[model samples]
Target: MSDATSRKVKRFSESDRNSEFDAATQKALEEIDVCQNEIDSINEKSSEEILKIEQKYNRLRKPFYEKRNNLISNIPNFWITAIMNHPDLSALLDETEEDCLHHLTKLEVEEFDDIKSGYWIKFYFEENPYFENSVITKEYHLDSATPTSESTQIIWKEGCSLAQNVEANKPGKKRRHEPAKTFFSWFNDNVDPYTDDIAEIIKDDLWLNPLQYYLVPDVEGDGENGVDAEEVSSSEDDEEREGGEEESRNQRK
Candidate 1:
């Protein structure tokens, strides 16, 4: 046999062939795979458990918000405060819409453990004669940052909360498309419930920001240009970081 071939062949007694180190290394690799699988299983179980708890908590939450229905709003301009607290989402709000969003009473989000149903937004509004309903609920089938309108659908529902007596005066008949020009007009249009699915309804971004998009002004939104401002701000931040890195490198010299 060639020298290399002879070297490659090892007997069981050889130190390198059956060494404890080699056995330990093999065992460690196997253990890593086992650990990874264990972690995955645990995470899956944990998520299910968390979702269960969320469902239970949501049950308690619903009644609490429902109690406020038809009652005077105690939280003054809650939507405005919520939006301003979040930088990125606030950037999406225009001056006009921000003022109009003050009337937003309650914004509830529904989460299904099953990823198929996706997430739902249930908006509770104060009585306004301008639109057909007070609550405009929509469910969007979005994954990550991409809106999967085909895989699922944006199931939209309008809730009439005019306390029966006031329902007769609902003004959707005359100026059919008038108030839509004002703030919250966007909600009146069921054709495209979102401002822009690709830009505004960034599913993951809202989740990350804890529903900052819900701070969306109660009026028709005017921040179609806000996304550009956000992009500029982000690019500026990146440049600042790069400049800091260059300064550090120069200091090292």
Candidate 2:
């Protein structure tokens, strides 16, 4: 068993009561422990089986993901537009990085052979005024209890660093209003990798289903079917409520 699955078990204390009742309580507790161990064993086995299934499907889905990327490449600014459409991702971005992201030619998520080990998120950019690097990548290593990540350091073209520009714009003294975090600033933030909110959003949400975000109606004008931005948001909210209800129903089942 993995160390993650074989940690020390929580021991139960006997109840303080008459000797006979205490003994009975202790015996019942022991029985409960045995049942719990059995449950854990099943859970461990289930996780192994699920990982195998995920690995198998990962290989199967590789070509489709590649094809999607190729198709997306043909659409001008598809990725940048999609990124701007996503609620969480859009929040991270500001006017400072908007032009920089326009040069983003491709974005890719590559899972390791052992999917549980970790994955890499790669951003490919055309030669632009902002940075020299053609490709910037963030790698997550998930071998231990706490996951750690490393990102490619961007070599900015002289005087064109968007992150630095944002910092420089901030007032020397504390202001009542703080400047919004630029998306590029995320590269330098030393956040916990395992629970990094942006990483989680990208991997589990955006990477899996970018089309949903991409299709979101632009608030600036009427979108497809004449739906407005507010309508799109409302639709999403309704879907979320329905999804939650369905999950609750499944749990009850």
Candidate 3:
């Protein structure tokens, strides 16, 4: 038994020395003087490093994987309905060709660097009305769903005001009552006929639903007071600039 143990120790020590020698040889190969040769060696080293990193972290990042999957799965179905009913934004989705729809549907939020940073929805369709360019790519932070007080207040006020106005008018009174619809429904009903076709398409597509929450411009005051478009534009610009700065910082990192 003592002799067997000695043999096992000898084998392990031999294996360890072989590993150290191989590592030293690889390091020497990487230090080659030729630029092209060095580049090739570096590429090989990088690939091996990447494989090691992936093997180590792939299981660790599984939570982010499940979170993104849950996010996509739990997205409300009504969102699609709302998008279809959006006046200004529905047209952008409508002009998208069938090929664009297929691509959009196949997009999955992927994890990068253990951060859910590269998860983006990209729409590549001609004549996109929502943005300056025909292609729209938007990255959403994982924590973007956390509501701010201002956003919560705006949502509550809009929904409550609309509901209150609808309930206030007595049905018995012979009021020239146009059907009281929500701001979004009214906008959809009133938009140009040209957009109606696209709006219908938006209603049918599932991918567009995820964007519905951002479809309508936030309205302030009742129809009597009206909203200031200039103020809204200025606020939007500020948000865009802040977002741009954040993106720049992220790129540097």
Task: Give the best candidate by lDDT.
Answer: 2
**Candidate number with greatest TM-score:** 2
Estimate the TM-score of every prediction: 0.40, 0.73, 0.25
Per-candidate Cα RMSD to the true structure, in Å, reads 18.0, 13.9, 25.1
Q: What residue pairs are clashing in model 3? A: none
- Candidate 2 contains a number of clashing pairs equal to 0
Q: The CA-based lDDT of model 2 is what?
A: 0.77
At residue 134, give the lDDT of candidate 2: 98
Runs with alpha carbons beyond 4 Å of true place in candidate 1 = 1-21, 68-90, 98-106, 113-117, 124-134, 142-253
lDDT of 2 by residue, 43-126 (tens): 989999999999999999999999999998898888888889998788888786888999999988998998989889899999
lDDT of 1 by residue, 154-252 (tens): 222345221221222233433232223322333333332233342243344543343344355544333356556566678889999999999999999
Backbone clashes, each candidate: 5, 0, 0
Query: Order the candidates by lDDT, highest first — what do you get?
Result: 2, 1, 3
Per-residue CA lDDT of candidate 3, range 1-253, in tens? 2454445445545565556557656444334323445476679899878867875686666576556546644443333334444554444343332222332212233334434222333333333222233444433334344311110111222222222242233323343335423322322232122223322343344333445443544464334336476766787899999999999999999
